[model samples]
Target chain A: MTPALELSSIEGGYEPGLPILRGASLAVAPGEIVALLGPNGAGKSTLVKAAAGLVPIWSGQVFLNGRDITRTPAHRMVQEGLGFVPQTENIFANLSVLENLQLAAALVPKDRRGELSKMFALFPDLERLRKLPAGRLSGGQRQMLAVARALVASPSVLMLDEPSAGLSPKLIGVVFERLQAVREAGVTILLVEQNVKAALAIADRAAVLVEGRERLVGAAADLAQDPRLAGLYLGAGLEAA
Target chain B: MLQLLADGLVVGSVIALGAVGLTLTYSILRFANFGQGEFLTWGAYLAVTALGFVVAVTGGGVMQPIGPFSFGWELLVAMVIAAALTAGLALLVDWLLFQRLRARGAAITLVIASFGAALALRNLLQFLYGTLPEYYTREIQIAIRLVPRDVLGGLRITPDQLLVIGMTGAVVLGLHLLLTRTTLGRAMRATAMNPALARVAGVDVAAVIRATWIIGAALAAVAGVFAGLVGQIRPGLGFELLLPLFAAAILGGIGSVWGAVLGGFIVGLAESFSVPIFGAEYRAATAFLVLIAILLLRPNGLFGEKP
Candidate 1:
């Protein structure tokens, strides 16, 4: 099957000459959850941002289900079935939870704007706190609101940058469960995570990256036991024990 | 005191309308937009020109005063035409100037460009209409006493003053509903809060920018027409009001609509009351003094979040 999102030999960065992603590439199949695990400065986030059209892709083709979306403006990518939730400022902090969802749904056609009820059903806590500003919510609740906000647009693929970053362990569990539920509902997910164990638990495949390059890619269960990941994450090669 | 209050309300209404547009543009675009005052000048001149055209084309039939008000139906029609034209001018300026500066991505550059635009626009008005002041109507209508002299030192207001206050109330209420109750408003708030996140969520940000200019310029046009109704219109009219308008916007909180309205009243009241204390010559100085005090006391203004 053609991957829902394919980034082949991508090279890009915030500026024209200083490329952070140098020939970095990854692909995720339809309805699959792919976890991109890497240390700080691994260019994982840049890879996804390049794919989302947020960063300038100097020389690489980003294909969404075989359709070239390279150079597509960030705002137009959503209509083409790409939804990106950044690690920070993902939800409108000043806006109420309900308003956040409504604003996302506005991107779709008028007839397709009834995703509020569906989102509320998925996150009942958000329904109760619908009137509160997202800023007032706890760290965990804000993350949930952010994810629900991205889902409100009903994109074919959802890309999140470190949804578990700064989240409590219990909240992280809840977020992973929500990601699984999203996958079961037929939407593919590409997650950039620092929490390798938690990510592998929900992801279909795990890709380990280092220094703007993919170091390893395989089944999540197999990659979970790989010694190289331990070495790469610690920034020191692991000794045989 | 009651007389000052009445005068303050009329002045406050014009400031409130102009401040709303100022705050809106400032919030979404992240620039002070020094050129915004010219929107007021342009609106006033446009309304007068439009009214002139209508009177000339119709042989002055529509120029007859309607009851107590000096303005006829032509003035009302002219205000609408002015608003539309002003909105168009705003969009045109955004496209021709601000949009290009925005693409280059420096807040200071945009501010400098706005100042350049302001100078150009104000001069263009002066070149076209001359520096001499103009009025919407030549007729001077007497103020009607609203409060008895024995009970409250005799508070009085003109028909046009009442209209300014009424229209300000209506426009502010309508804007409140738009920002709080509509999807477009939510998108605007979201964009103001985080442009990148709003775009990622699928908002047509360009469309939002266009709408912002339209709404902001339209409100400015109404305020300009009211300013002309209440006072005289000259090339320097908008420039003279610029400092007070900024004072009101900062006093209300930079990005909050309700804050702008309250700030307008506070600034207007300060100016009106200062006429007795500091004399009329220092009225503009009082407005700047109030702004400095607010900044010293509450750096975030009344409703602004601390940067």
Candidate 2:
């Protein structure tokens, strides 16, 4: 089967001197949940941004569903069945919850409105608060709203950058539950997470990002089982392994 | 005297018309454009010349009224031409000056540049028309009297003032409908609230700004024409009008349409009323005073959210 997302040795940066993602590469097939794991400042967000067309890629090419989209702007990416939810400032505070989703729906292919309506059933909470201003939403509710906004577009592949970043543990569980529901719907999902163990437990595939580079790539179970992950992530220092 | 208020309503009507343009520009462009005032002056002058030429060709005179109510076809035609020309000229300014500045990521500098633009436009008008105060040949024959007989020694409302008030209502009505019920209008509001987000949502921002310039400058031009007809026509016509026009925009909320209209009439009436107590020379200055007072009390004009 064709990979949903394929990054072939991409090198990208916001500035000339310091490249954010340097010759990093990864791929995921449709209906798969892939976890991108890293320590803080590992260029994980940078890699996702470059692939999403937010960051400028100085070298290499990116492909979405086998089509080359190396230099496509973010909005065009949205049109091409790719949706990105950034790690920060993901929603317009002044607009109503319904307005945000309406904007996303406005981008959907006209023929797929029926399918889009089915997708909206995944997050019923959003429907309840649709008319409320986005600013008034709780941290968890806002994250849900952000995801719902993107999902309303009925994108083929969704890239979420730390969707659970600011949420409480209970909310994080709720967020992942929604992700599992999304994965069940046959859409490919690529997620970046600092919460390593939980993400690994849920992911089919995993990639470890270092400073502008990918240090390891493997099955999520294999990475989680490896003893070194405790030291690489946990502040108790690297345990003898 | 009641005559002062009748005159107040007249002056207020003119200010409301002129100020709407400035307010709309402020809302769409997200800046206080000092040059907006000069568009009014240019519009007025253009109408004077264009309509005068039309009348000359038609063999009409100031002695004859166009119909029963107001100025002739010459005035109406000139007003339309002036509005179109001003909008065109404003686009030129946007292309040559403000557009590049925005692209370069210059914010405050653009505000200062607008001031420079206003000054340049003013001086250019002075050069072409000379410093003389010119008037449109009065073509209207009817005089509408509404004031009580005992008040301020026979106060009267001119046909021009009545027409201006009516025009103001029509302009506001047209603008409201356009903004609320159209796709282009919705896109403009979306862009104004958040430009980057609007672009991401498939709005053509460049086109919106261009349309905004056209709308804003057109209003300014018509306002300029009314001011000339109501009072005098000169290079300083717009310059003097700026403060009160801005007062209305600020009063309405810098970017809000309803706010601009409300602010326009308020500043207009304030300036007119002040004329009685402080003399006609103090008219323009009254706008600033009211603005300062509003700034102290609300600081966001009357209806606008703080920027």
Candidate 3:
């Protein structure tokens, strides 16, 4: 079966001639959560951002459900059923929670605008604080709102860049639980995360990126037990073993 | 005191309209567009030209006074046409200049380019309309005393000034609704706050930028026409108001619409009230003083969030 989202030999970065992602590639299967794990400067976020069309791709191909979308503008990605959530400043803080969701929903075609009530149902705290400015939300609640904003467009695949970055362990668990619920709701997820253990717990598959490329790809259950996973993060080449 | 209040409000209406555009452009585009004043100038001159065309087409009768106002349906129609044309001019400037500069990804460069664009636009207006001041109508509008001389120094306002104040209120209200209730408005606010996130959420940011120019320039046009009606139109009209416009935008908070309106009025009132103590020569100085005070006390502006 074709992957829901595919990045092939991607090389990109913020500026030309200074690539952060060098030949990184990954494929996320439909209806499965694939966590993109990597250490600092591993180009994990860069890989997903390039696929989402936020970062410029120097040379690569990004396929969404088998359709080439490498040259698609970032704004058009949503209409094409691809959603991205940045790690920082992901939510429009100046906008109220309802306005944030409403703004996202308004961008998609009327038929594809997923029910706001469904999102509010999934994140009940958001429904309670719907009228509050997103800036005022707690760390975990902001993450929930960011996830809900991306989900509001009803994209086929959602890519999140470090949703668990600033949250407490308990909040991370709460957020991870919500991600599981989101996956059960039938959306493919490519999550870029630093909290490896929490991410692996929910992800069916995980790709470990090292030095701008995915150096390891395995089932989450097996990878969690593999000693090489820790080595890859420690900057020790797998080939050295 | 009442007369000063009335005069201040009349002036405030124009500043408010201009500042709203400035604030919106600053919020969304992330640049202090020095060329904004030229839009006001262009709008005024465009109305002057459109009004002439309208009067010529419909005959001299269209120029007849409507009720207490000095202008008739001809000027009103001209104001609408000028507004559309001014919006077009703004789009053209964006396409020909700002868009290319935007691709370079430098805010300071855009600001510098706007200064250049402003010079070009102002000079072009001068070339077309000349340095002599023009008026929409030569009809004299007598100021009506609304209060007795004993009551708080009384109040007197011309019909044109009243119209300016009334129209400003209506336009600002419409804008408020558009920002708070409409999808496009929210998109603008979103784009202003976080453009990258807005794009990922599926907002066509380029289209939003274009819409912003249209709305901002269109309001500038209305303000221009009102300025021409209340006083005289000249190539330097907008340039003259540029200081107060920036003062109002910053005072109200660089991104807030209502803040601009309130800032405009405060600046206008301060200037009017200052004339008594500081003399007419220092009217413009009051805006700078208010701007400095606001900067010192509330750097984030009245409505702006801490950066």
Candidate 4:
């Protein structure tokens, strides 16, 4: 079956000559959660951002449900059925929680706007704090709001960069549990995460990126047991492993 | 003191309107657009041209005074047309200049371009309208005394001044509703706070930028027309108010709308009260002194988020 989201031999960066994502590639199946795992400067976030159209792609092809969207503008990606959530500044801090969700919901056609109510149902805490500014939300609550904002457009694919970054272990578990529930709702997820154990617990498959490329791809259950996973994260050569 | 307070409010209304646009542009576009003053100048001059057209088309009856106000229904119609035209002008300038500079992703370049655009726009207005000041109406009215001379230094105001104050309140209320209730307003606020996130959330950021120019320019146009009603329209009208506009925006915490309005009033009152100590010629200087003093105490501005 065709994957829901696909990145093929992507190469790109902020500057022309300085590439952050070099020949990186991944494919996420429909309704599956795929964690993109890597160490610092591994280009994990860069790969996702490039696919989302935030970072310029020097040469690559990004396919959403088999349609090429490599050249699409970042703002139009949601309309094209792709959503991205950055690790930092992911929420509009100055806007109230309801305004944030309403703003995102407005981008969809009128009939699809009802998804906003469904979001409030999915994240009841957000509904309770609907009138509060997003900046005042706790770390975990902010992550929920960010994910909800992306989900408001009802995109076929959702990519989040490190939703568990600043949260406590319990909050990370809570957030990952929500991600699992989101997957059951029929959305494909490409999650870039540093919290490997938490990500693997929810992800069906995980891709370990090293030096701007995916160096390992396996089922989450198998990858969690593989000693090479730690070696990859530790910058150990494949020969050493 | 009462008369000064009344006069200060009248002046503050115009400054508040103009500063709203300046602050919005600064917040969203991430630049101090010196060309904003030209929008005010252009708005005023555009109203003059539009009013002349309206009078020519509707006959002199349209120019007849409406109740206590000096201007007729024609001037109101002209103000609307001028606002639309000013919005279009702002969009055109953005398309021709700012948009290109924006692609370069340098705030300073956009600022420098705005200065050049301002100079070009002001000189173009001078060339088109000539150096002579223009007026919306020639009829004059006497100030009505609201209080006796013994009662707190007396109070006096003209019908036009009251209209300015009332209209400013209505416009500001409308803007407040737009910001708080409308989807576009939320999008604008979202874009202002976090542009990248706004885009990922499916907002068309380019459309938001266009809307910013339209709303900002439209407000500036109304302010220009009001200024002309209170004083006279000239090439330097907007340029003269530019400093105070910036001061007001900065004082209110560059991105806060209500802050801009309050800052405008404070600056206006300072200028008005300073007429006694510093003299009328130093009115502008007094505004800067207030700005400096306030900045020294609160560097981020009154409403601005602490960095």
Q: State the lDDT of candidate 1 residue by residue for B189-280, as single tens digits.
A: 99899998888888878999999999999999899999999999988777877888899999999998999898888888899999999999
> Model 4 off-target regions past 4 Å?
B60-62
**Ranked candidates (DockQ, high to low):** 3, 4, 1, 2
Per-model interface RMSD values are 0.9, 3.0, 0.7, 0.9
Candidate achieving higher TM-score, 1 or 3: 3
Best by DockQ: 3
What value does the TM-score of chain B take for model 4? 0.98
- State which candidate has the highest TM-score: 3
Worst 10 residues of 4 chain B by lDDT: B59-68
> Whole-model Cα lDDT per candidate?
0.89, 0.79, 0.93, 0.92
- In candidate 2, which residue ranges exceed 4 Å CA deviation? A104-120, A183-186, A197-203, A227-241, B1-29, B46-68, B72-81, B128-137, B147-156, B177-180
- Candidate 1: residue B284 Cα off by (Å): 0.9
Native contact fraction (fnat) of model 4: 0.91
How big is the positional error of residue B72 in model 2, measured in Å on the Cα after superposition? 4.4
Residue pairs whose backbone atoms clash in candidate 1: B252-B259
For model 2 the local lDDT of residue A42 reads 78
